[model samples]
Target: MLETHGLTANYGQFRALFGVDITVAAGECVAIIGANGAGKSTLMRSIAGVIRNAAAMVVHRGEPIGALSSAEIMKRGIAMVPEGRRLFASLTVEENLLIGGQARKAPGPWSLDAVYQLFPVLRERRKSPGTALSGGQQQMVAIGRALMSNPELLLCDEISLGLAPVVIRDIYAALPKIREGGAAIVVVEQDIGKALAVADRVYCMMEGRVTLVSKAAEVTRRQIHAAYFGEAA
Candidate 1:
């Protein structure tokens, strides 16, 4: 449902992505895996409209949206859970979630109660400051906040960045339920195992270019290792 064609990005002439092409089909889960500085997050930001590019660079369901603002993109049924889980420090857990929906009031299955159902602990601590939550709980709130927008495409950047294995597992375990709602997901992750485990297709990037693209079930660890390090097997 989303695709990028020759998408390039730069930070004041220091290019971060090089002619990167990728796609995520409706209701499918795609994983982007790479080492630090490999441009995974850059690609995500570009697609989500955080970094502006040529009008034809990014496409959603056949229309180019690369030039749209991030807020406009969210209104167009795409929401991003940024790398840092950048929740509003002053807002309570419930308030943070509430604001996410206020931006784009599209109708979907996600609601205050529905998000609470997805992460039960969020319901219990609805009135607590969002920053006061534990790391895993904070991550849950981030995900919940994104879902509040009822987006058709969800961009998750580094959802497992600093959490424990069990916590990561807990976060991933929510994917099936999320998918059941019919939203396509793009996960930018550093945890190879977790990425491969939940992805239908995988793309490995290195030094701002796509080095490998394969079906998750068909890709071998050796292939991932080779692509991740830019080496030939």
Candidate 2:
């Protein structure tokens, strides 16, 4: 459903991605695992159009979307949860979700009620400020907010970064239902076990390039460690 070919990204002269290639087939769940400064988030940002790249960089369902704006990409069915769960602190929980549908409003399997069902606590905290929620609840709100867009591909960057183990499990437990709803997923995570547990395939990056791509079930822990740290196993 999504592919990046020779995707390179730069912030001024400091390039973050170096000819990175990635693919996520329809209905597939892929995870990107790498250490700090490995450019995992850079790839996600490029695909989401938050970081512009060359016209040939990112392709979605066979069409090029490298130069499109973030809003344009979201309208085209690519929604991102972002690295830090960047929710609008001023917006109420319900209001934040309501805004997520403002891009196109194309009818799909997701809506306010369905999102609340995915994270029932969100329903109870509907009127609370986004910042008032705990980190786990805030992450749920971020995921629910993305689902509100009813996207075909959901890009989750560092979804479990700072959450507790139980909270991470709770967050991941929502993936099956999300996949059942037919959204292709690409998750960028530092947690190897979590990535392996939920991803159908995994890609490991080092210094802005993909060094390893394998079936999650087939890739060994040592292999992941090597790719993550740029060391020989």
Candidate 3:
């Protein structure tokens, strides 16, 4: 489980988040949704430890980890599939996946072969340069790379961004399996439908603050529109 309390972030002099608070229970899938610049990515980066915050801001299993380094965070059983799927262009798919396990090999159900099972095409393209793969395939590689760490908490930032609907569906389909494997997921996504469909709870953010938090299945479009855009749809 993870929690962020009064979490704030800044870009030089520009503040990006304002006292944001949220939580994810063990094995639950939580989604953060908002328009561009709504601080969704910022929130993810903060949680992933890419951007340092007050030591008490981000807590994992009741431990204060907001100020931990990204690598430290990874070693603590939290892995991030960053926005843009920053795969190594020079590394082969298998090599990229291997790099994930190199940091910390925490015991879990994810392995090279298990990841391949989650996304079968990855096994077929194991030796191909990561960038040589199609967008959807590349995304799969990104997810596979994170899973290779066998993290307890996985932070996915925009996994569906820029992919075709079918391709996005393929990627989203792996969420339940990942959950079944016992990892809690916090997905930062723009596709409202996909986010709500996969998440148990959804947080709608606007201008760097949380405007709505609801059970995903029960959320209405009008509420999301209002919370996301600050007005009625």
Which candidate ranks first by TM-score, i.e. highest? 1
Residue-by-residue lDDT tens digits, candidate 2, 158-183: 99989999999999999989999999
What TM-score does each of the candidates earn?
Answer: 0.98, 0.97, 0.98
Taking all chains together, the TM-score of candidate 2 against the true structure is: 0.97
Q: C-alpha displacement of 193 in model 3, angstroms?
A: 0.8
Can you write out model 1's per-residue Cα lDDT over 1-233, one digit (the tens) per residue?
89999999999979999999998999999999999999999998998889999979999989999999999999999999999999999999999999889878889999999999999999999999999999999999999999999999999999998998898988999998999998999999988888989999999999999999999999999999999898896
Ranking by lDDT: 3, 1, 2
Which ranking of candidates, highest TM-score first? 1, 3, 2
What is the per-residue lDDT of model 3 for residues 1-233, given as tens digits with 9 covering 90 to 100? 89999999999999999999999999999999999999999999999899999989999999999999999999998999999999999999999999998867778999999999999999999999999999999999999999999998999999998999999989999999999999999999988999999999999999999999999999999999899778865
Backbone clashes for every candidate come to 0, 0, 0
lDDT score, candidate 2: 0.92
